[model samples]
Target: MLREALDEANNWIGKVPGVVMVGEGRAQDGSPTVDVWVTQPVSLPQKVKGVEVRVRNSGDIQAQ
Candidate 1:
């Protein structure tokens, strides 16, 4: 499921600007979730196609 979610999120990389990386992670409740690390604040959809999205801004320029 994580792989599928990562794949779905990867599809938005090029299409959506400011996306730094996308990976599988856990939610606050320990449920599996998709993590999207972004460099800057960008308008994003709650879900990409049907996959839920979790956007985070770490302000880590080393990644940029």
Candidate 2:
């Protein structure tokens, strides 16, 4: 179930402007969770398409 949400976020929701990467990761509390990597600190909705969106930083993104 968690992995499915990760896939959906990668294949579908990743198209969102701020989304950087979507995959399985750990919650801040160190628990297993899904991750939605982003380049900025935007206020994302609590969930996307019913799956909770956990936004993490992608550090520095450069296209050069």
Candidate 3:
């Protein structure tokens, strides 16, 4: 279930402005979640395919 949501998010993540990364993770309550990292605040759905979506601001990502 989580994998499905992760794949679905990854498929269109590039279309969203400010998004940098998306991955699978466990929420504070231990429930499955799709973590979304962004360089700035952006509007996103609260849930995707029944999985919770958590968004975090990661600032600018640079290659080292």
lDDT by residue (25-51, candidate 1, tens digit) is 777788777778888888776765555
Better of 1 and 2 by lDDT: 1
In order of appearance, the predictions have TM-scores of: 0.72, 0.63, 0.89
What digit string (tens of lDDT, one per residue) describes model 2 on residues 1-64?
A: 6767677667765787877777776666765566778887766566645556677899888788
Against the true structure, whose TM-score is highest?
Answer: 3
RMSD of each: 2.6, 2.9, 1.1
- lDDT of residue 55 for candidate 3: 92
Q: Which ten contiguous residues of candidate 3 have the minimum total lDDT? A: 11-20
| Residue pairs of candidate 3 with colliding backbone atoms | none
Which rank order by lDDT, best down to worst?
3, 1, 2
**CA lDDT of each prediction against the hidden true structure:** 0.73, 0.71, 0.89
**Candidate 2: Cα lDDT at 55:** 76
Model 1: pairs clashing at backbone N, Cα or C within 3 Å: none
Model 1: CA > 4 A from native: 48-51
